[model samples]
Target chain A: MELWYSEMHTEDVKFSIRIKEQLLADKSQFQQIDVFESNEFGRFFTLDGLIMVTEKDEFIYHDMIVHVPMATNPNIKNVLVIGAGDGGTVRELSRYKSIEKIDVVEIDKLVVDVCLEYFPNTSVGFKDPRVELFYEDGLKFVRNKGSKYDLIIVDSTDPFGPGEGLFTKEFYGNCYKALTEDGILVNQHESPYYSSYAKSMQRAHKRINEFFPIARVYQAHIPTYPSGHWLFGFASKKYDPLEFDSKKWNELGLKTRYYNTNLHTACFALPNYVIDFLEESKND
Target chain B: MELWYSEMHTEDVKFSIRIKEQLLADKSQFQQIDVFESNEFGRFFTLDGLIMVTEKDEFIYHDMIVHVPMATNPNIKNVLVIGAGDGGTVRELSRYKSIEKIDVVEIDKLVVDVCLEYFPNTSVGFKDPRVELFYEDGLKFVRNKGSKYDLIIVDSTDPFGPGEGLFTKEFYGNCYKALTEDGILVNQHESPYYSSYAKSMQRAHKRINEFFPIARVYQAHIPTYPSGHWLFGFASKKYDPLEFDSKKWNELGLKTRYYNTNLHTACFALPNYVIDFLEESKND
Candidate 1:
């Protein structure tokens, strides 16, 4: 018998993988979590049936999300990660030896537990000395924590279910208040392809633009995601991602699979249509 | 009951679209052609069950394929397009009033006929007076031709079945022979994320590097394709795509949805993993 797991990218589009075995299916307080093993993508876990990470392409996500912000400000000693319950975001952050403290706030303890049991490579950071895990709502954690973190990375899910609060204007305002003067706020910015995701992305970009002096979006090619094209939001008070000194970034000599000094600038070069669409979206 | 069309990105990974209706299905002399309408991608057609163009995102493919080479050499007056039966490539090329002629060679006539009927936005260039449609094998057409075209575009399908010859060393050699001294060659280089497509991309790049003095690959976000991250090859005898005078391209003032001056340079700044993979492929 053949078993396949499919997720609808849109109402009309679906992506499926042939599954060898179903590893686990548990309903957490927040959402439905399922883990499965597949020949193509290795082991993958989903939150509410939406692919969160796969052993195959998680590196691309981790490398892009963590490194883009870190490389922008090499002095980012205090790091805060929100909703990265799978531990992949913290895994990449822990690689930077200069980082002194790493705090992760996850609303779901079950996700961290499930990933720790199945995805060892990504969940490895949970045991790192510099890493501290907090099982709580990310939106509430940063409410009054002013200027604590040099980098705040919101490694969130979609703009629905438990993840929806993380995309609110109030959440972004809190993130702004929680950041140091040079702090960089990076969040999951959905995608620009499908309308469902694009709306979320546009909404997030607009909200973030209101709270930060510098706001931009960058892209990565992650095949496990809905469209295989995913985006990340970078908002800052002073440092623009494009203006970061490449010489300093290269000096760090961080060995990354996807993120590099050259790609730092390249990622921000939005397509002309996207530039126009984003500009026009401000009026709406 | 809802109907769907699925394409195997790999043996174990599949991408499917819910079909509002199957617009057309027939077997031509070379391959099977299918067309479907979906709310997500609008009207899309597949050749041998693989998506060729969609009303929604065909601009990304056509813009990246045609304009990248055009901007590199604005003096390009004559062009040869291989297997672009959809005529989208021709549509983009025809916009350049400086161009004197366009020759499109397609092995399958039914693909063109189908697209002309369904995809008017792309197929509009077929009605241009400058377009000369050739119902012939691209390999055979350019075999002995020497310095005939300022540009050659191999907008063929996957490196299999009808499109097999387009990826062969012999075919690239023929394309090299058929180009003017400052000639540029662009082709769909496939995606680097999936191993099947990556192998084809690696093989094509290596073969082209053997013949051309300058060879590089660029990327685009084409969601309907295998990985949504698709690549295109740029090869030239005299003009390097990067060193091309950008001031000249901007003067032409071509309004585009995807391609622009910034992306012209940014597209070539590929991920480190892709760069390493492409380089390692040289010895493969």
Candidate 2:
């Protein structure tokens, strides 16, 4: 059988590639992970019907999703990542020396097992003493958690099917409550190019803004994601990601493939459509 | 007939939608140009086999391509755009008061004619007195041109059919010659994600850098374009787009969907893969 790895950018759009071999398959964790060498799209990795990585452009998605919010809040010592089962986000987040605790809440245990087995590099930080793995529903985890975090990063899948609740205003509200006073929260907002998710993003921003004093939508270029352009939502109680000390971020000396202090500020400078949505929501 | 619009991010990957009707079709130019109201990907427009503008999200591509170079050189008075048949680039460029003359070289008369008919908003700038339309090959125009331009923007199609030459080193060298001493040249480099056209881009950069003092590649979030992330090449003799006067650009009062002074500087920050290519080429 010709194995192919496909990523659903949306229910209507997907990108697929022929694969050389299935690297690992763990049915117990509800994840069948595979690493395949491909002629195009570089080294392809997939888990639970989702594309985890491609050799040609993994850093763009991994670094932007992790580092932007981390850099935004310099005092972020405790971080929580929801649904980054593949551990790519954790690997990137581990680079920060100040991060004393990195908690990963993934619903699927298979994804973690497969990632550790085949995609070792992405899962390298999973075994670190600073990291804690939680096999629980992301929405429930945020709802029930008593401990406040300095930074919470939602590196979940698309806001459809298993990931539907991830996009709800309720989850965002819970996230707002779960963070410390100066806490910052970042979530993977879907492609504004294709779905009604932009409205969902706007709605989430509205709800989060009601709780937190600051909420902003930023963009990153992720080719495999639907529409190739993906938006990330940042909500903070007091700190603005844009007003960071650049000299300090430079001193941290994170050898990044993408994210820097210059980019950290620029990513927040959203396009007019996004700005208009925020403005329109205020009037409503 | 139910017309379906598909944006093939690559030959292997596509995102499509069914349309209610074909809004306009003009066969006067070298390629057939058509616009349609589509259920997915929004208002769809096509030139030949290439997707041009979809009502939903074209500003990402248009603004990044136009404003990056314009921001780099604030004193730009005369601008030349090559192969922007839709006139989206012109609409963006025309916003600046410093831009006195805007010349557009498009080989396909059909694209311009159809754009004027169907995509009137994008084509609106063509009626501006400062605009000059040349229905000729961009390469041919650059070779024969005597006058120099402060900025040259290549807003051509992909490097497949008619646009094949636009991606070549010869075309870039000619673009170098067509600009004034302080002139800057910007072209839509293909996606660093899917298209290994980075080699071609690197080659062009090498050839152009030999003549021009500085050349660099910047990125934009263009979901419709191949790989969802797009790269733009900037080559200049004197001006750096990053060190421009933001106060003046703010005064230009260019109502843009995406480009701002912050983004202008941020676009130049490259990923390690892109930087590696530039460095590799430098060593060679």
Candidate 3:
């Protein structure tokens, strides 16, 4: 039988690569994790129904997700990452010297184990002393936690099947309760071009804004995502993401694939339609 | 007969809608232009195997293409747009009172006519006396033109079939020769995620950089385009895109869909891979 690695950008759109072996498949978390060495795009890891990384373009997604929220808050010593089993987020988050602890809550232990075995580079940083792995439901873990985190990063899958609840208002409210004072939360919202996803994101942002003092939506261009254009929601109690210190970001000297001080500010400048949605939702 | 409006996101992937009628089809141009009223996405436009617009998301692409270069060069007066048959660029450009004259060079009369009829809102400002239409090849028009333009915008199709030559060294050289001393040139480069188109864009930028003193690449989140992430190349004889007069842009008071002062500066911040490409090309 021919083995292939596929990333379902949408229900109808799936990008696939023929593979020589089934590196790993984990069904417990409702995700089939696989590692495939390809002739063209390089060795890739697919979790749930998405292409998480290849040797070529892994940095682009990793850097933007971690650095944007971290740079926005200078005192983010404690970080919580939900659903990043490939360890790419941990790898990037480890660059921050001020980050004392990174608690990763991934439901699937198989994804973590497969990534460690096949993708050494992505898994290398997870062995750091600052890192703690908890194999459990991200939603449940956040709801039960007593201590608050400085930053919460939701690097979950698409809003379908197992990851569907990730886009709900209830999940967002639980996240709000899981953060400390002056805490900031960033979640990977869907593509704004697709109205279905954009609508869901807007609804989630509206719900989160009620709990947090400020809620803003930002954008990043990731080619592998549904529309190539992806949105992220940032909710904070006291800080505005645009008012970060550029000098501090520069001093961090983080060699990143995408995120920078200029981009950190620019990402928050939403298109008029999005601003209109926020305004329209406010009247309701 | 079932009329379907199919937007080819890539050779393999397409976002299609079943339509009831052939609203408008222009065959004079190399690509067939069609506008149809769809059940889900509203009125949509497709050209040369690509999705140009839908009633809902047109503002995002149109505003970013026009406002970014205009905001970058605040003193722009004489503007020249090549291949903007839909008049979206003209509509956005007319928002600036600083623009004294706007000339558009389009190869297909049918595209202009169809857009004028079907997309009336987008095509409204083209009737302004300051705007002049030229039904000619943009490449040839620029070569023979005697007048120097303050801003030149190349809103052409993809780099294959009819628009292939637009992404050439000769075309960029002519564009350099056609501009005023302080003129800025902005053209839609292909998505960097696709290697074939990305390499072509890299070559075009490499050649254009040899002629213009400063050349840089920026991105706009365009969903219809291949890889959904689109890139634009800006070449200037004088004036940096980042060093813009924000006060002048604010005075213009253009209600845009996407382009803002913060995004105007931030879009130029490239990822490490793109930066590395430019650096490597510089050495060669």
User: Each candidate's DockQ score against the native complex?
Assistant: 0.87, 0.50, 0.42
Candidate 2 segments exceeding 4 Å error: A1-14, A19-38, A42-56, A73-75, A143-148, A167-170, A173-177, B1-12, B15-37, B42-48, B71-75, B96-98
Chain A (candidate 3) TM-score to true chain A: 0.89
In order of DockQ, best first, we have 1, 2, 3
Native interface contact recovery, all models:
0.89, 0.56, 0.49
Could you give the CAPRI-style class of model 2? Answer: medium
Each model's C-alpha lDDT?
A: 0.91, 0.76, 0.78
lDDT accuracy of residue B133 in candidate 1? 96
For A1-284, candidate 2 gives per-residue lDDT tens digits of 66656665555455666666655554553445566776666566665566657665677888888877777677788888999887788988888888899989998887777667766767887977899999998999999566479889988876665567887878888888888887888887766665466676666666667777888878877766556667888888888877878887788888887676667787777666667877776666
Interface RMSD (one decimal) of model 3 = 3.8
Q: A199-264, model 1: which lDDT tens digit per residue?
A: 898899889999999999999989889888788999999888898889987887778888888899
For model 2 the local lDDT of residue B249 reads 71
lDDT of 1 by residue, B187-218 (tens): 99999988889999999999999999999999
Evaluated with DockQ, which candidate comes out highest?
1
Tens-digit lDDT string for candidate 2 (B168-212) = 777877887788888888888776665456665666566666767
What TM-score does chain B alone reach in each candidate, compared with the true chain B?
0.98, 0.90, 0.92
Error of 3 at A108 (Å): 2.8
Number of backbone-clashing residue pairs for each candidate, in the order shown: 0, 3, 1
